[model samples]
Target chain A: MLKVNEQTRQFQSGITIGELANKYKPAADLFILNGFPVAADAAVQDGDSCTLIQKDVIPTPDEIDSFLIARHTPGIQTKIKQSTIAILGLGGLGSAVAGAMAKIGIGKMLLSDYDVVEPSNLNRQHYFIDQIGMLKTDALKANLLRMNPSISLKIIRERLTESLLPGHFSNVDVLIECFDDPVMKAATLRSVLTEMKTVAYVGSSGMAGFGDNNKIHTKMERPGIYIVGDETSEARPGMGLMAPRVGIAAHHQANQALRIILGADKGRK
Target chain B: MNITLNGNNKSIQEISSVLDLLKSLELTPETVVVELNTTIIQPDSYDTTNIAEDDWVEIIRFVGGG
Candidate 1:
């Protein structure tokens, strides 16, 4: 028995991958044997898994999903596909977080951003130069779809206030706060931690300046509340937001979301 | 009086409420999230919530940036 793109089939005892591809899927131009790319002449044995890829072939949604599952760690893709994540403030941090989540095949995302993509945002954000003047929600959605089309998105094109948060994020498994304003960050964190106690909250504090990357860290302030950053750096005159440092913090938030989804954060509270 | 403030044992002049505690630390109420005894204290209750001795208080100040 052999697994081919998640479908099991009985094949000859010792057949070359090229022969198998010719017999099973002749259109396949790329071959992956047991999770690694291999030459066509690689041998496939019993109980081995192979994924055949055809260049220029548009895969179905199920095919795309199956491919993602094959690439992820065993038994983790299901949980990732079932989780819904909410990202507030689609700026440098939020945009990068959304991109990472989408690549991991998150089931759904609740995205809220009221601002448009400006020229300055191109420096650190995920938006392209042509996306200038477009709403961050729309621009990010377009870019994310290019990565994973099956991801479900709920875009809110309005500023998030304390009163508006519960209605938008009450159902999400994890709520990530990515606002750039200090006041908004404090207010949003207070609202979610106070009102939505069941949601795992990840917030960012200091990702400004081209300082030491080691200074940025993910600290679980309390159970269900994680803050990632150096805890002191602020974006002001002389200390500005750069890509490398901001990307570090954004990926920290993304990894925390994954950890929470995979139950790694459990029992720590 | 003595209390654990931001994970540091600090001895400060006696204060009454959360607002007063903020004043002692020089932190503005609107700019920080105050958690007392593992529970988040709403901003509106800062004037009414009291800080008992040995209470674990975690105050996180928000700085501008993504």
Candidate 2:
């Protein structure tokens, strides 16, 4: 028999459950709900007997990069350092994906792209005038470094052919499918599945006059591999992909990646 | 036939190859991917892949937002 409220106090003393999360929003995030250590808003059951918890959001990739290179790189764990990620394209989705990864402090990244900045890209991509006509991999690498100077970056300014991919991609922990081509995305999906057993995340939509990129639905293919902004699989969209739409897809991809790394996404997908 | 995506069906098309169908719908390869009968067909192969009658083809595109 389980005894709840053993150390029970008064008034504010209540057990955590799926319903109570709304009230104790702060502590609700840290409680282990549904058998995983997650935020307080996670669910629980009556008489489950759990403890309250609290957590702090970490700094963005830019800050972590500076810190690691200047101070903490040596101390970070090998499991984390050994974790490698591949970002297929460097357009709207890839740019956002890179920013998210850098902020979350992924140990290493394989940023690959075979495009250059154009005037049209300026309207949506995370690139500036000086970067126009410059290689996307170069520009992204510069920005990524600014985000986290210490990250072990292995950038490939080439298309992700099977040969080029076999080396850098084989040992990666996760692969972010942010490529722009439908063929590339399709070919890429098959490529990742064939190469390593690494968890892969892909961006599916977002490319139009002016679309919102933060609201797309992301799905997990493997328990860990996920695809964000899937316009069809989720029965969500049936329109032309636009800028913000792809951005939303990228955001979902990023959110899931972070959730998985922290062990918070367990069964929550 | 009735269908929904994100939830809406702006236009309808009745055609053969996905490329032709999309062109008839005025959709471009740069903006979307064709989901024919739950299978995703790459834009490069849109010319060769045929869309069967009554096939549920989902054309998805990118829209901008934060």
Candidate 3:
């Protein structure tokens, strides 16, 4: 055990991240929402100034950091370093997913969203009013680059069909399903589940509301097939995806991807 | 009973079923994923997926973004 000197924050040795969350519930909620951890072993060095640290205000632990045990956990920066994911939609869920894939340091991303930003999208979509007429794939590209200049992005602006998807899925490790039409989404899922032989995971998302919710449904089929949000969850004009909810789903998808890449048992996740 | 939920330990009533515990997170039946002791519990089965005192659960969300 490390000693916490006068300069140290309150000592919380050997406390699991979650236990600390309970001790500081508000902070914990924030951390969980943001995908941070509550690792109790984290030390505030003597003489170092500190502030209240809410452990949950971040994404899942990608690698074991100083606060959390350092494992090459899949979603930590490491898995993003090791894998490639193909995102199938670039609207509400797709844009959020793409932005997250870059911010979290995923190695490569193939983004496909045939839609264009509309004046209506400004309310919930991440795009700016200035980007209103731009194709979603292009707008997303510009936005993602701003988020992480080093990310490798492959953009496809055309609406994709089953045939178009296969060529892209060629070397992809994971598939993120987020199509606009329910029938198309189902078709894409079925196609990927059948044809993408090398794919280990497929993550789907569906969120349509103003609030950033921590609530969403994610699926991991056959180890690598994962889904986030409800692809079929239709968003009404005022109820389309808000940043927080979309962000939460994006965070979870990245976490699952990192976990799988690390060989960390999905159960361990 | 003490068990882990998303890497943190918490004390739940010894008899709290997996479904009951999920209700505490305020996740809708349509959102949220529940993996109890490594198995992904289907939505229809969650109402009956009784969590053991020693079980480990990972609760994740699927929100829309970007």
* Chain A TM-score of each candidate structure, as shown: 0.88, 0.62, 0.64
> Comparing 1 and 3 by DockQ, which wins?
1
Q: Candidate 2: where are CA atoms >4 Å away? A: A1-82, A162-164, A206-215, A230-243, A266-269, B1-66
Candidate models: Cα lDDT each? 0.89, 0.59, 0.61
| Cα distance off (Å), candidate 1, residue A169 | 0.7
Report candidate 2's fraction of native contacts.
Answer: 0.09
Ranking by lDDT: 1, 3, 2
Q: List the RMSD of every prediction in angstroms.
A: 3.2, 13.1, 16.9
| Model 1 clashing residue pairs (backbone) | none
Residue runs of model 3 more than 4 Å from their true location after superposition: A1-78, A210-215, A230-233, A236-239, A265-269, B1-66
DockQ scores of the candidates: 0.76, 0.08, 0.10
Residue A184 accuracy (lDDT) in model 2: 60
Candidate 2 C-alpha lDDT tens digits along A37-107: 65444445444544444446544555355444433344343335545677778887788888877765678
- Alpha-carbon TM-score of each model against the true structure: 0.87, 0.54, 0.54
Per-residue lDDT tens digits for candidate 3, residues A1-269, read: 21111122354445443444455433533222123332444433333322234443443333113222222233464555667878887765667667766766677898887788998667556788889899988888898877766668898878787667777776777677666555455556555555665665555556666443544766654455666665444555556656666667666766666666566634212
Which regions of candidate 1 deviate over 4 angstroms?
A1-18, A29-51, A267-269, B45-55
Better candidate by lDDT, 1 or 2: 1
Better candidate number, 1 or 2, judged by TM-score:
1
Per-residue error for A107 in candidate 1, Å, reads 0.9
Q: After superposition, how far is residue B27 of candidate 3 from its true place, in Å?
A: 24
